[model samples]
Target: MGRYTMKSVSLNRLPIGSGLPKICIPIVAHTQEEVMKTAVQVVRSPADLVEWRLDFFDSLSPETVLETATELRQMLHGLPLLATFRSHREGGQQQTDDSAGIRIYHCLMDRQLAEAVDLELSQPADIRRSILSLARQTDTKVVMSYHDFRRTPSQKTIEGILGKMAAEQADIAKIAVMPQTPADVLRLLSATVSARSRLNIPVVTMAMGPLGKLSRISGSLTGSAITFGILDHASAPGQIEAGLLKNFLDELTVDQ
Candidate 1:
C-alpha cells in the first residue's frame, strides 16, 4: 500500500515508479462474448492493466459478473486487474442502489476478483473504512478516487481529499474533474503538482472534457501515477488512444 511517506508497494508484484508503460483499459461490455473480445484486444495491444467496469455490463447480473471475473482472470493470466463499479455521481451506470452497490463491491473484494479496486471518495467514511480494511486483508490495492463533473476545487480542498486518502492508506490517489475554462484546468494541474510534491502517494490526476483534455496526456509530466488511454476502447467521453498516447509520451519524455 502507498503511504504519506515514499515506500515501495508492489501491484501484483509489478514494481512501479520505474518509468515503465502502465496502461489501464476500461471494459465496457456486458455478456461473456464482449468481455472475451476485450480480453483478446488487451493481449494484442499494449495495455498493461485491465479494468473491468462492472457497471458497464448491460445484462450485468451478479452471477454473470462472478463468472466473467473468473474467466477474465484465466484470460488475463498475470496482468493486473481493476474492478470498479462506479456510482452515477462519478460518471457510471445509475442502475444500482447504495446498499446493493456496497454489497456487490464487498462481494468482488471477498472473492479476490481483482488485483486492484476503485472506490469513490464521496462515500461515507465508515463504508470507506470497511472496504479499505477488507482490501488490506486480501492484500488488494485500493485506488481511492474523486471525480468532479461540475468544477475543479482549489488546491487546498484537493489536498484535503488526497490527505484523507493518505490517512486511509490508499494505494493510489486518483482525481478527475470537469473543467469549464483554461484556468480551471490549471487549478486542477496545480493541485496535482502540490499533492504530488508534498503527499506521499502515487497520484493520478486528469481533467475530463475538451477543455480539460490536456491533463489526460500530461499526467506523468505533473507527477501523476497513471495516464489513461484507450488501448482498445474508450471509457470516458474524451480519451486518447494507446498508440497515440505512447507517441505523445515519447516525444514529451523529459529525461531528468
Candidate 2:
C-alpha cells in the first residue's frame, strides 16, 4: 500500500489506488481479428484493466471505433475498458485532427462504451473542458494524461501538471515521461508521491523506457494507482509482460 491516503475509483468492482497497483494492458492491434485474439490472451493474463489504443487501428471512423469498443467490452468479460486515442505529438502511432478526435470521444461517451476515457492534458482548454463535461454527464471516468517523450520535467513541474488535472475534476491524473537519467526517474516518482498526498484523485505515473522500469514496478509504494503492462504487444516502451508484472506487484505488496 502507499503511504498516502487517497480516494479510490471502482472499475467493475475492482478498487484502483486502494492497495496494490493494478496492471492495464493496451490492445494495439490493427485488425479486428488481431484485437480479438489479443483480448483473449489478456483475459487469461493477470491484468486488471484493458486500454484500447485507437490510433493503432487502421480504420478509426466513429462507426468503426464504436463497433470495436462494443465488441471489446463483451470480449473483455467485465474487465474495465480504457479508451485512448493518443495524438501523434505524444508518441502515438498516427496523427489525427483535434476536431475528429473530439468527435470520436463524444461518440464513445454518448454510447457508453468505455468505462474510462483518456484525454490529453495538452489539448486546448476549451476542448478539454468540453470532453470533461461530457464525461461527467455520462458518468464516465476521465483519465487526464500527459506524456513527455523527450524527457522528464522537474519534480515541481510534474506536480503542477497533476494539480492542474485534479483541478479539471478528472477521476485519475496520469503522467508518463521519458527518463534520461536515474534522477529523472526519481523526480517522476517524487511528483507522484507529492500529488497523491495533496490531491484527492488517483495518480498514475510512470517513467517510460528501460531506464525507468523500476518506477513502473515500484508505483504501488510511491502512490501511483495504475501501471501499463504488455499483453500480446506493447503500446509503449518499457512495459513488462502482464504475468511477470503482476507477480512483481504481488511480491512487493506482500512484502509491505
Candidate 3:
C-alpha cells in the first residue's frame, strides 16, 4: 500500500485523491439544470469527484456547452471535475469520426472546466499532445485512457499503453478491458501490479462485465487508484451503481 501515496488535489479548494474512497459519479444530462441537479446528486452521493460525460449532451451546442460548463463549474463550487468525451468506438455516447473526435477533444479542453480530461490513448501523438497542451494552458492534468471493447489485451500491451502515457507526461493512465473469462481478469490484475511496481504515475484499471466484476473489488489491492460508478445510467455499458461500488470496495478493504 505504501507504493501508492495518495495525494490530494485542491479543486477551487475541495480536495481530491486524498487516499479516501473516491466515488466517481458519471453524469449524462442534456440541460443545464439537469446537469446541475445531477451534480447536486453527486454531492449527495458523496462522490470524491464528478465525471461529466459530455457525449451525453444531446442538445449541446458549442455556445450552450460553454455556458453549461461555466454554470456547472460554478455550481460544483469546489469539487474537482473530470470531463470526458469518450468516443462511441471506445464505448462512449459520441459516435464521432476521426476529425470530429479531434474537434470535440480540442473544444472541450479549451474550456478548461474540468480539473482533468480523459483522452483516448489510441489517438495520434500529435492530437494527444495538442489536447494535453491545452490542459497545461489551464494547468489541468491529462488522463490518457485506453479501452478494449472486444476483449482484453495481453499484459505486455497494457504495459505498453501505460508506458506511452508516461512518455507523454500524462498525470494519470487508465485502462479498461472486457474480460471473456476468469483468466482474463487475472491478466488485468497482474498488469495493474506490474504497472504500479514499475511506474510512479497513478492508474485507473478495471475489467468490465460480469466475468470481470471481481477485478473491480480486488482492483485497489492490484493497484487501481480510482473506481468508476454510476448512480443511475452508466455512461459506459457495464458498470455498477455508486452504492454497489461502495459496498463492494468496502467489503474488499475490510480488515482482512
Candidate 4:
C-alpha cells in the first residue's frame, strides 16, 4: 500500500500521532484499594494515558469490573483511561473466555467508563464488529491489538498484523512482541515505521524484553504513536519508568 498521511487518534483531547509519542502507564493491581493507590501515583506521574489491566484484578465479574472502572475513571480526573482485558493467550495475567470478556467491555462502554477500550484482533469477526459498533455509539475509541510473547515475527508478518487492525476500522492499532535476538527488535521497529507510514490510523508497536528496551524508547523515531511505561510496576517486559521514558522521548524528539 502507498504511504498515507498519518492521522492522529484523540483520547480525551490528547492527539496521539501528531507529536512525540505519548507515555502510557499500566495499573496492574489485584484489589480496588491497590488500583486506586496506583492510579493516584500515575496521576502525579508523567504518564499521558493510563491502562487498567483488568486481567490482573482478582475478580472478572462484570459488576466488580464496572464498579472499579467507574471509580478509577473518576480518580483519573482527565487522564485518559484505556481499559484492557488482556487474554492469557496474549500475555494477560489471567484466563478468560471471549463471551465474558465481551460482556465486560459492553458494561464499560454502556456507562462510558473509559475513554478507550482494547479489543483483541484475535477475536472472531462478528465479535469484533459488535464491539466496534458499540464503541461508536458510546463515542469511545477502539484499540485493536495483537500480541506475541514468544518471539517477534518477521517484519512482513508484523506489518500484516497491523494491516489487519486497520482493516477492522480500529481507531488505533497496537502490537507487542517478544524479541529472542537483537535483530528481532529491529524487525519490530522496521515494521512499525512501515505501518505508521501507510496506515491512516495511529500505530503503537513495541518489542518486549531487555533487548527490546530500544523499541520502547525509540517510538518517536519508529513512528509508534504511544509507548507503555511503568509507574509502580511494569505491565510488560522492558517497559522503562514513565518519568525516565518521558525524558528519553523528549531527548530523541525531533523539532518539527
Candidate 5:
C-alpha cells in the first residue's frame, strides 16, 4: 500500500512489500515445552509470519537450538519462520559471543529451518558479510537490523542507518528505536517514509514504548513491509496483540 520504489521477497509465496504490511508474531520462551505452547497460539493468531527469539531460549547450543527449531517448524504448519538471535545490547534477553551466534545461524540456514534470518548491522562488517554469503548460498532471506533502545536519532541518522543496511545487501532492513517524546515518533515515521521511498529493498522501522505505539500500526502509510505483533509475550515494547493489530492494519488499509 506504500507508494515506494521497492522489491518484494517471497516467504512461502507471501510477497512482502507488495501490498498490505505483513503481521509477524514473536515467540519468546525459555523451554521447548513453553516454546511449543506459544507456537500453538501463534498458529491460531492472525500472523503472516513468526519470529523465534533464540536469545530467550535457555539453551543456545547448536544441537538443542536446531532440534527445537525443527520441532517449531512442524508445529507452525508451514507458517514462515524468522530466526533471530538478538544480542543483549539490542534488547535481547541473552548475551552470546559473535562466533557462537554465527554458528547457530549457519545451522539454521544450512538446514533451511527458517525462511528468514535477522543479523544485527552493529556486528562487525566481516562477520555480517560472511553471514550474508551463507544466506545467499542457502537461499535464505537476510534482514539486517539495528536497534536503539534509548532515543530516536535524528531523521537523517535513521535514514543513514537504513541506507547502510541496503548497502550491506540485506533482503530487508529494520530499525527499532525508543522515542522520548511524540515528536520523536514523528521523526521515526518521517525517516521510514524517506527510506521506504529511496531504498530498493523493503524497510521496517518503529519507535518503541507507549509514546511510539502509533508507528507500529502506521506501516501502510510509512512504507514498512512488516509489523511485529505479540502472541504470548512482546519481544519489543508497545506491541499489541496479533488479532487486534491485524484489525488495525485491515482498517487502515481499507481507509487508504
Candidate 6:
C-alpha cells in the first residue's frame, strides 16, 4: 500500500496518532485498594494513557463501577483514562450479556468517568450503536475493538472488521489477534497497514503471544497508533513492561 496517514484524536490534551505510538497501560485490579495502588504506580510510569479493565472488579453494579472509575480518574491526575469492560468471549474477565454491558457503558459515560471508552464490535449492532451515540453525547472517545484469542483471521477479514468499526463512527479501531506463527504476525501487521490507509480513524492492532512480540514494538511503523504495555501486571499476553517498552520506542524513534 502507498503511504498512509491517520487522523489524531485528542484525549485529555494528549494527541494520539500524531507521531510515535502511545503506550497504554491497563489496571486489572479486583478491589478498590488494589486499583488505587496500581493507579499510583501507573501515574509515575512513562505510560501515555491508562485503561481500567472494569471487568476485573468483583462488583459490576452501575454504582460500584462508576465509583471505582471516578477514583481511578482522580488518581490518574490528568492521564487520560480508558474504561473497558471486555467480554469473556473477547478475552475479558467477565461473562456479561448485552444488556448488562450496555448498562455499564451508559453508567460510565453518563458520569464522564473516563476520557475514552472501549466497546467491542462483536456485540449486537443496536447495542454498539447506542453505546457509540451515548459516548458521543458525553464527549468521550470510543475505541471500537475486535479480539480473536484463538487465531488471527485472514487480512481480508481483518480489513473488513476495521471498515465496519470505522463505518460505525468510532474514534478508533482496534484489533488484537493471537498468532501461532511468524507469518500470522505479518498478516496481522499487513492488515493493519491496509486498514489504516482506507479509514479516517486511528487503528490499534496487535499480534498476541511470544511469537508475535515483534508486532507490538514495530506497530507504529506500520499503522497502529497505540500499543498496550504492562504497569504492575499484564492484561494480555506478549505485553512488555511499561519502562522497557518506552525505552524501546525511544530507541526506535532515534534510529528512524
Look at candidate 3 and tell me the lDDT of residue 159: 86
What tens digits encode model 6's per-residue C-alpha lDDT throughout 1-256? 2223348889998888667789999999999899999998998899899988888888888888888888788888999999888888888887777577678878888988888989999888888888888888999999999999999999999999999999999999999999988889999999987887788999899999898888888755776888899976789999999899988877766222
| Number of backbone-clashing residue pairs for each candidate, in the order shown | 1, 0, 0, 0, 0, 0
Candidate 4 has an lDDT of: 0.89
Compared with the true structure, what per-residue lDDT tens digits does model 3 show for residues 1-256?
Answer: 3424453344445434334336678888877778988977777785667888887787545777778877887877667788787787787766766565556556666776678888888887788878888878877877789998789999999888887887888888889999988888899999987886677577778888878777766654776777778877776656788888888877776321
Give the alpha carbon lDDT tens digit for every residue of 142-204 in model 2: 999999989999999999999999999999999999999999998888888788889999999
Regions of candidate 6 where Cα sits further than 4 Å from its true position: 1-6, 254-256
Worst ten in a row by lDDT for model 6? 1-10
Candidate 4: tens digits of C-alpha lDDT, residues 147-256? 99898889999999999899889999999999999889888888988888899899999988899999988877888888999976888888998888989999987643
lDDT of 5 at 146: 95
Q: Give Cα-based local distance difference scores for all models.
A: 0.76, 0.88, 0.75, 0.89, 0.89, 0.86
TM-scores, each model vs. reference: 0.91, 0.96, 0.88, 0.95, 0.96, 0.95
Candidate 4 residue-wise lDDT at 87: 85
Q: In model 5, which range of ten residues has the least summed lDDT? A: 1-10
Candidate 3 stretches greater than 4 Å from native: 1-3, 6-21, 98-108, 254-256
Which residue pairs collide, candidate 4? none
> RMSD in angstroms, candidate 1?
3.0
Model 2, C-alpha of 166: deviation from truth (Å): 0.3
**TM-score, prediction 3:** 0.88
Rank list by lDDT: 5, 4, 2, 6, 1, 3
- Tens digit per residue, CA lDDT, model 5, 1-256: 3344358888878788768889999999999999999998988899899999888889888889999999999999989999999988898886667776788999999999999999999999899999999999999999999999999999999999999999989999999999998999999999998898888899998888889889999988888889999976899999988999999988887323
Off by over 4 Å in 4: 1-5
List model 1 lDDT by residue over 1-256, tens digit each: 2212243346787644435335677888877899998888876766678788887777556687788888998898787888888888788875676565667667777898888888888889898989899999988898899988888888788878888888889988888888878998898888877887777778778888878768876655566656667865677756778778767766665433
